[model samples]
Target: MHRSLFNILSGRNTRQGLWGLPLLVALLISLWLTVETTQFATAENLFNLVAQAMPLIIAAIGQLVVVLIGGLDLSVGSVISFTTAVLALDQPAIVLIPAVFLLAALIGLINGLAITRFNVHPIIATLSTQYIVLGITRILRPVSGGTVPEIVIAAVSGSFLGIPYPVFWGIVVIVAAWKLLYGSRYGLHLFAIGGGIASGAESAARNFGVSDRRNIILAYMVCSCFAAVAGVFLAGRIVSGDPNVGLLFELDTVTAVALGGTQLSGGIGSLHGTVIGALVMALLANGMNLANVSPFVQTAIKGGILLAVVGLQSRKKMGL
Candidate 1:
């Protein structure tokens, strides 16, 4: 009975109406925390917050594409970590940077293909790939250290005025992605593909009447590209390609996306929501750390928040 009720309610537009919740909740949390803490509102503090969050934003952007195709790319975190390790190879700036982005895209492509061809769920396929990629990276590097060119560091860490470059990049990517992911025709299909693939597939697919056959490929492609960019951006900021980079990033990115009201079941989303969600995630994390919460406890809080929000959406849709 419970499962039937959930299935019935799950078929609604809960994603569209919840865009502002993340921002509002984040604001309240930040304000409450800031009122009690001195570091929450400082320009320096803001700069650091944005800087630390750049990777999450970047990874989430990539993950957004994966989500759009009604697929999850769990391997992305491992991919990011792998790319970071590659960047730590101490290669020339020109060579290392390009390689990172390309590799990321390749991994995404492989993920898409693996899912499509192997008749496997994206979660399972990517999970398997995640292990493989992590193993390879660990066997090859086993540690993290590399020097990003000074210019690269300045571009990501430092800012033009008082603003950090990280914030600027986030804004730029958010705008561009908003325009590309939500403001265009193809973007519309991505959303529709998740709602009702059988009814909508004929319109969305060109080859075999599947909703977004090409789009599925492209979605994974975009996800991987962003993952690569995130890896490089972090490497530039950190000035090293640490082996441990992006550990558990998939959980954070997925949580942010889900928190932004993108349905885990797929076929709905907004980049704007994702942007707000990323900010919320950063604030939640920062606030927790500043409060000196235990890492395990913080993880519990994060997971709980996701579960609670998803539960609310589920119940609301059921007319509860």
Candidate 2:
């Protein structure tokens, strides 16, 4: 029994990575917050916490998809911002909502094409797209003043059976992601592709009849669509468009992904791990806010946590 527990905790011989460690960390953080503040465990605050973390959770799931194939999407934040900008445009919900996702898909397609077909590095290609999209978003909403569709607003603003809509939103997103990543053939192909790349055999999966190019492109498209979903959630909560709303989100999502025990080199991760990792981040942010810590300090702390987490991984596994 003891050995079995250790294997579970250690993630021995498992592709799920070191998720148990983050689960422990999340529990510890929750315990600390519960003990440290009178308001931390209050129902209102708990609901607020779930609402605040929903966007990151959704976006990180998308990030996880890309990371599984040993790729990164720096454009996630920009895509998110762009989505809100589009949603807030002077248009009908029918037109704006579909347009937002369509644009996001296009952005992802471009990013994928640049990397896969043009032989561009993932970082460079996504970074360039990030700038382009951010520029366009800024042009659309210079200072966060446009109104989002009423339906979008309504979707996030109420409660159902004593539970906030954001909680339901999270459940839906998590279930969908679980289906895509664990229950689908595409998800299996993703792991297979990523594993081969991580092992320095990029063509290994291809030898098994997988179309790496198409799958990788679809992964990027999926990532952008997920980011769009996050943006929609944020738009409803904020009730308006804010070009800067998604600022630094890419950093946070990547940090959350890494914290969740997803390998930077790819092919090793779990959805539960990512959720746990995001909860840890959200918990820390909530705790620090309650303690009256400066936002700057919190940002620095996040950067430090990211660095430490990445630093702990073996350079070989990181493909460095």
Candidate 3:
């Protein structure tokens, strides 16, 4: 039994299984909701669900990259908050949009440098940055009242060929992330670094000529840039730049990544898994809302789900 379990959790079987599990879970949840309530299966509800999941889908994909490199960015929520605040200013898109991206990238660079150059722990580095960015975000917009450009809202929320723009954007992120992570040399280095960090094989990876620093920097940059994108979409959705909008987004992204079967210790994961994971989260929340579950209970249930998923991975690692 132990050997069989190991076999199931190892090799391509494990990868394929993990990649598909979230989809299966999401489907089951959708089916349950369809049977339990009339509010979940309509085309309008489906579009709304996809719209709600877009920012998270993008954020989770970005977080997956950092996780692949064996690190965490607790500042993603803060970055989103900051971006929304910046974008809320009555500035032109040509200026504010690029500015937000650059600011986010700068934050990522600093995070990478803190971890690589200064040897700061990833958690500490990101946590500190989170606080800094959040403070600035609050200062920028002490509250949630600011205008989001109407054009931005129309562009993000508009549909083409019967598909919402957010859903299309989510699909694009998934495909691009899949190719970049699973089909490129840089991706190889990232996986190597991640695996090395987890297994204490950094020397071996370096000897294999992996530029850990460059890959780590790039990973963080990608993560921040994606978070910024999510922020933009969120700003458009709410039509304002609320400082508190993305308060718990980091938790959601991390949980989604974990639920998707990405090892928290790093190395093994897929964008497909993350996409399905995000979908599962959206469905779960939708189901809960439809059931009239309390908001507090929903948070607790989500936390429990995260813990259970992470525990399962730990158990698998232990071959238990």
Where does candidate 2 have its weakest 10-residue lDDT segment?
311-320
lDDT of each: 0.74, 0.91, 0.85
Best lDDT among the predictions, by candidate number = 2
- Per-residue CA lDDT of candidate 2, range 211-248, in tens? 99999999999999999999999999998888999898
lDDT-wise, the better of 2 and 3 is: 2
C-alpha-based local distance difference test score of model 2: 0.91
Show model 3 residue runs off by greater than 4 Å.
Answer: 1-17, 315-320
Q: What is the lDDT of residue 81 in candidate 3?
A: 91
TM-scores for every candidate against the unseen true structure: 0.88, 0.98, 0.93
Clashing pairs in 1: 144-242, 194-267
* Number of the top TM-score candidate: 2
Once fitted onto the true fold, the runs of candidate 1 whose alpha carbons sit more than 4 angstroms away are: 1-17, 198-211, 315-320
Q: Model 3: per-residue lDDT, tens digit, 1-320?
A: 77665554442455322655676688889999999899899999988999889899999999989988779999999999999999999988889989999999999999999998999988899999999999999999999978877777887879999888987787777778878987899888888887777676656578888889988988999999999999999999988998998888888998899888788777777777888888899998888888889989988888898889878674223211
What order do you get sorting by TM-score, best first?
A: 2, 3, 1
**TM-score attained by model 3:** 0.93
- Candidate 3 lDDT at 204 equals 57
Question: Between candidates 2 and 3, which one is better according to TM-score?
Answer: 2
lDDT of 2 at 89: 90
